[model samples]
Target: MINIANTKTSSTEQKNTPMAFLELAFRPFFLCASFFSIISLLLWGAMLNGSFTADVYGGALWWHKHEMLFGFVSAIIVGFLLTAVQNWTGVRSLNGKGLLGLFILWLLGRVLFLMPVNLSPWFIILVDITFLPLAAAALAYPIIQVKLWRNLMFIPILLIMTLINIVMHYSIVSQSPQLMNNASTAMVLLVTLIMTIMGGRVFPMFTANGTQTPRVNAVGWLEKVVIITTLVALIISFNIIDLPTEFKAGIYFIAAVAHAARAFRWKVWVTLKTPLVWSLHFSYWCIAIGLLLFGVAELSATVSQSQAVHLLTVGAMGTMILSMISRVSLGHTGRAIVASKLMTFAFITIILSTIFRVFGSYFLTDYSQVINTAIVFWVIAYGCFVYIYLPILTKAKPGY
Candidate 1:
């Protein structure tokens, strides 16, 4: 029901400054995510062996996941919502030093946390957790001013995610057991919620727009079904570390069915032509399939969590982010919505990456291979964005 086109470009800001940094949303965050991702993964890979040294952080692996989920992905989320919220509410989003300050906080958190806990972890925590709330506040202001109720929901979700990251960081430092479990569960749920919200909003709209056909919502009941099953999957996951095999198996089976049913009604067959569109459709399908495969593992002890999370991470999250970033960049910069040949190549690269990552999980039967291959594809997907869209992200819109 959101009229996306109507809400875009309402309050215009000048883009003629000597600095062209504020031209669009993807500029700072995409740049940051790209550089940080490469460095972060390399750091995590090193830390896995005990070769990595840091002053304050206890577990390197924990720091790795924390950075990936909270640090890296969080940057992308901020860039995205800032732009999207501006579009949805017809308000000018953050720019100038405010935007740069947010990026710097993220950068400093990375640097500070990696070193010894010198003065206090409090300083690092404050910087690490501040970005999301600030982003939420920026987005929420305009939406609330216009009495936009639906978009308002995203603010609290961001807040909760930020809080979860806060708790997770504290738990890592203090060694609180429950905090770790809760944060992991919360991150998975947040990922699922992201899949649903963006999937629902963009999939049908993209399909209809690209195809010049009437729009199609997935299914009336599927929305509720998706949320319930995602939660069910998370709840069952917690029990896996402790509960009996049979108990976990039963719950996972239910979760799998719910996930598959939720995704099936979307009619992915019709979306194949638009790589951007189909990639998302396929990605959501991966979420369902991953859940289903996970259920199979629980019930029959076939595939492992490592395998299933690969499917979700590489298949669902990887492709979705690639598709969204590609589309959002063109649309936001006042460019035509058509993908260039090179951009189209980027799309294919991501799909291949998803396929390789998922297959590495299933076929190679090596956990490291799966992670390695998935990281390759992730780099391919995001690297392609940096390669092709850098100009769009960095330059002012034509009229600006």
Candidate 2:
């Protein structure tokens, strides 16, 4: 069996002793995510209220979106993936200088994004787009050596996301509104695709394992149809600029069937017992619901696309990512499956935050209020994630 316990001295460790506040997976980025998330949103709030003064290369909206995706999400992605890749592969993993370098690359991206004119587009591109793929490369190296090909597909997705991000930047520089809109839609679709594939594999698997039952790998014809439909819809949605509404809705319905099948595959009856596991199943369901609603918006002319997207972002993505980070960090760190009360509270906070965000999306007539409400959930969800995982990441897994 693969060893989940990590014992090496963390980079945060100094002179044969563990460092406080820097001891585990959650410490550094939780602090970073905590501070950066607040600051990023505050800047966003200011940008919206006509008070924020920072002009990141392209503009406030561009900066806000770019940093939110590339910086904040990227940082969290690296921290979680790097830490887990080590545990997943039993490799020594990136730490010490290697870890430090990756973190610096992330910081530099932020700095370059903030200073608009000093850097060329290429300069900004180099800084912003380099980290995730590099992190993926770092991760894949060990996994590939061990023949973990299944996980390798994530590399190309990471690369494509990087490419899309670059396109977003250059579209800004070129003043190509068309290209910018295309890139924007592509990025969101990429996020959706990620939700589709990763959620498919992990959600059911985690639910089954967490609940101590038969592996609920829903294998059947409907599941196969769902998978196929999801790919077709995602590609058609992203590729076709003015796709016919009827066609898009058909694809969305197929994908929703698939997503819901995946969610239901692992009997949620077993899940309700564990909030951590149930939260994941719940989040995946939200993705299905959001995608279908998005398709409905396109076809029926009733629902708003923005509403569908937020359901994924504020509801599904936020919830699922936080739940996984908490569970993975704890499980890999040699902690028991049982979360501490504080950790449980943190998870609850994120859920409540998600409720606020999703409800605000529909109820709050003002766009700014919607953004404000979403930010709270975003911060709290991630904040709670960081709150629990920081120690788990910093310290080596419990058993030496």
Candidate 3:
């Protein structure tokens, strides 16, 4: 659905940029998202150890969950979409002062959430909910101008995420922890759906190009089944409909099977030699496994929902974000797409972090230690990214 082939910036469009970093949405958003993720994770670890105390709005736990989704992940999603829409429609997206204003708007939401000064809950909600809609508008304009109807699906998804964010804030005002948890789970499922759709588009293409293999053709029926089942699972996760546990479990299992089968057609085995390609395959498998485990959690007494969620969060989302940003940054910036040695190690560490976060509770007696260890791996993984990519992100692309 994305026109990966049409990524070159026209000279006329390039003339509008005042600075390199602010020239494209991906530059600032990716940099900020990576740094914020590390800071958020460290604060989370400190919160677990009882060392960090901040009078963050919505309490610490709620801030951690909400910020990771609406704060960190949302930034990356906006960045990727805005940048990709340019390629899809051959229309320039937000850039220069306009892009900076949007970035500042997003930053204000994150800052207001953690500021020690007491603030009206309504004011914060207004600031936070405004980013996505504006971003959706920025994204929608280009597609509509070019009549790229197929790419328009992302606008509604962004608006829906904004709606979920509103519900999350309302849960805090209502003092309903259950509602907050449900909203968070729904947000996670919604992100998984985004990943599912995007991965289906790019994984086979990336794998084939990286490995010099023939691209696998998608079966129309199977593709439809995958999207339909994922939508059902997402609806169930929202807890809007009162579905039985068995019925919910059945939907999850069907989604899981559909994802796994769809992934198999992507030629995952051949990607192992290429970290950039295989990391994506590994992350997609995490989604499939996470969905299956989610079904098991619903049906079985032993498996907790939290464990499955960590797999999707730390494994699927974290790894995939790192992989995508790494590759996208290089390609867009006019560099070769090869992963550096340190970057490759970063990829491996993130995968380890996911494994520990998801399975460590089952094998280890001390849950705190499991979480701490997972945090350490995560820090190392993302730390490598910041260290290696800082210069690449800040400096102008060679000969630009």
Candidate 4:
């Protein structure tokens, strides 16, 4: 005889089993983002050191740049938006099978790009560029259901990113190296704009919440100025070749001052006691300093553009992503948002990595040695993340 009550109970338990890890967007996506960052950096460092000298899709250097911009960073963006939309709308996004499918699409994109298979251009295009739009679709239902018009801004940003990815793919497929470089730079600037917007919202809140501060000091006019000037700078950055050198430097210089002035209002100094808090502040500081140096590099011969970009990438994006994932994974998993001692050291190493990559490479004569040192710190920073957070990500929630 079939027991109906027992069968229902068994099914309920099955749904709440270890599979609950995938029930939220953060679990699988954060794990994948961290792991992919580690593997990609390993490959990039090895290539720089003459350890492996083979191209993946278009060329070795392009492959590295493309994956970091489109692959790893995109994964983080999707994870964050998916999880965030659910919270914003009080509606459920993808879970279980739907979430798994989205993740598989991302994984397949990585594979199709790196694997030594001569797939058709259209096939690669279908695989590489489909993930972000699907993610947007997953969010659109909830966002539109509640008439969240203001939040619709992210949809266009995601679509632009998708278009940029497509342009990058076309460049590679058509064998246009110059187009690929321009698209890659555009993608970098686009991601930076996204970071700037999100950081402005969260960093202040996190600082106030973490430090038990009563106020978040922000001026409305200054905030609007920051956004407007940042947009102007991004437009010029994308069209940098057409613009004169002095104009580019002037735009970037204004952006640097605006960013630094805004960051000063965020109460960064009070949060220095907490690793999780200060890391966010320090990363934003990098963006401001990097922009200033980026403008200076355009005018002078000593500080290279490549060096300035590394500061933004390694110092700003890399550290901010690392710190954010650490905090998000813990809080979402129902754990206390506190950093372990080892994790604090991990944070320090990443900051050091950025300093070495930017300043050390600029000041020191031996660039190779500077790069090698930076890579070691980068690995250790992410390596600690995998070590500390793997179990947190893979297992079911502590209470569950």
Candidate 5:
């Protein structure tokens, strides 16, 4: 297990704050992300049931989607990258006051978006969108110092995501609902692309390590096909280029087959006995299944686009991120990388939640009940995360 304390931190920071949690990137950010997951779901459920609404400038549904994607998920991405970049380059990323400042900026954006205060759309954009580029800047200096050109790919993705967010806000400003929807859809595809890249890097490696098996290898041609086809599908999905649905479906179907082929080569079945390992594999499978459904939905009138998207969002992205944050938190905090019983249960519950959210619409006549059931499962999953890790994240790292 990798320990955060083993990372190169100076003695000045070691003694600067009694709150050792602020001394590293993952501590506060992961804690906040997990907490926000719970709160956001509950509020979204209430919005679905007509109990209450958010105070944001966009409609409640848009606010919910944006916050869940950008507000909550982005925190995990930044936290993981900040922590990982240090290990990659042997240089400090963010620590002490700098991390705290970033966290505060994130909190400010969330508050401005959720509260009833009358903030300008441009103001929200300014506060909310600053976090990603700033995070990229923090990582860039170290990566450049090490002359790691490949690692620089993440910066462009961050900038693109930031651009999408700005475009989303501009859509709100102009009251163009379709534009807002398109921008949000683009953001989702962009995140999925990032997940595809990261999952390709880590899933097979983790499976090899955990299962004591030979490293699962990627097929060179398959990787290239997936990247090219997924980019095409994303462009078509963006709907900004005015592509035909038939063309989008064809590209999406090809992307789906390629992703499934690659994932199958990873031998995920061997990971079943290990919750931590299997969760990663299972979530990857979710992406493959989601993409297949996404393509079919474009071609078939019977399948709902919402279901396919949820399969990716809730089943794949949510489950993968939750498992990762849990695993990484445990490893970095000087604990065993093994998942606890509660954590295992959390993983299972989230997978079940994904099933309900993604497929329940087809099974049941009333969609609201499906949403309610899925929300309950989501709460349980994230609640377990907060229950298990809240104290660990706040306290000093072991031997600090």
Candidate 6:
């Protein structure tokens, strides 16, 4: 029961404010996440073509994976949740110097990952691992004060993500590829679970409001089944439970079906007229499809795990983040919730990027070309976001 209402501010309050950017958590975080994602993708593209080389913490492959999840995606998650929690619990989240400190802590972790000078692994871990727990604490305080027990689920999820991040960094120290791979997969699933929970809460409401349609009621039993199955799939992904391949596949398949059914109740077809709404629906479908493909990969020789993962990462996470930020930034800033024409094009481009990255691998002969093409689209998509939203994020809302 998180409230999604817009916060109102007086024009006099916002006018002539010197440090408006640091006045809220979303401003600095959303801006930084967009820029960081663009740079990271460019570096990844260069590394793929052998034009760039870097000796960073845990090597380039590890850095790319770790940063995209813990670095890029995690920033957006914290920013969104911190902002939303304010609306949820009717208490102010971090702002001003306090918000800046948390943002700097996250930025420092990213800086350490890219520094040419060899840094102590422990130092990097200490900095990188500190952000989430602090964010969790900030999030928990307001909810606890209000006794909003229903909203407290997010605290544990953040803490668990922190634990997984620690394990990921430790994999580098232990030099265990299996551990690294398992931890990475686990993080992906964990984020997907976050998306599942958040999307279920917000998407239907968003779709109904945006489309002027009646709100669809969620089946309580189905909601619980979807979440429980997703948790089981996540546990299986982490290798925490010893399950047969068939059993694992079954759990994933059930989760996928449950997700699809849940989405079907939202009347996704009607959302085609709205880019902001449709993009979310499409992204959620990617999770359903991704889960099915991932389950198939476990039992079939034809399906590759990387393909399934790319579908979830690029299609589900990337598009959903872009769409959510676009809508949230506008709404929070007192602008209309509609997407600009260019922003709509950016949305389409990112979906294309995911298609090329995931399905192109199956059809194309030159794998490098597929990877590079996807990178180009990704850069264009996020580049548009950074360009269009820069002013909107930096300045006070119009009419304040």
Per-model TM against the reference: 0.86, 0.85, 0.97, 0.93, 0.95, 0.97
> What lDDT score is found at residue 263 in candidate 4?
87
- TM-score of candidate 6 against the unseen true structure: 0.97
254-298, model 2: which lDDT tens digit per residue?
788778777776688888778788777777878788878878888
The parts of candidate 2 lying over 4 Å away from their true place are 1-31, 240-242, 395-400
Candidates in order: C-alpha RMSD to true structure = 3.3, 3.6, 1.3, 5.9, 2.2, 1.6
Off-target runs (Cα >4 Å) in candidate 6 are: 10-18
Q: Model 3 over residues 1-400: C-alpha lDDT tens digits?
A: 7534325665655666777788789889998888898888888888888998888889988999999999999999999998898888877888989999999999999889888376887888899999999999999999999898988999999999999999999998899999999999999999999999888888889999999999999999999988999888888888877889999999889999999999998978898889999999999999999999999999996878998888999999999999999998888888889899999999999988998899998788998888888988988988998888788777666776
lDDT against the true structure, each candidate: 0.69, 0.68, 0.89, 0.80, 0.83, 0.89
TM-score, candidate 3, is: 0.97
Residue 327 error, candidate 2, Å: 1.1
Which scores better on TM-score, 1 or 3? 3
The RMSD (Cα, Å) of candidate 1 is 3.3
lDDT of 4 by residue, 1-400 (tens): 0000100113444365448667677778888877887788778778888997665776677888888888888888888777777777766667778889999999888877776466875776798889999988887888899988778788889899998888888887788877787787777767778778888777877887789886686788888877776777667765545888898898788888989998898878899889999999998888788888879998998888777788788898899989988988887677788999999999999998998988896578987788778878998999999899889888766655
> What tens digits encode model 1's per-residue C-alpha lDDT throughout 126-228?
8778878988887788898888888888788889888788778878777976677557656765776677667766677787888777787666676776676
- Model 2, global lDDT: 0.68
RMSD (Cα, Å) of model 2: 3.6
Off by over 4 Å in 5: 1-13, 16-18
- Cα deviation at 312, candidate 6, in Å, is 1.1
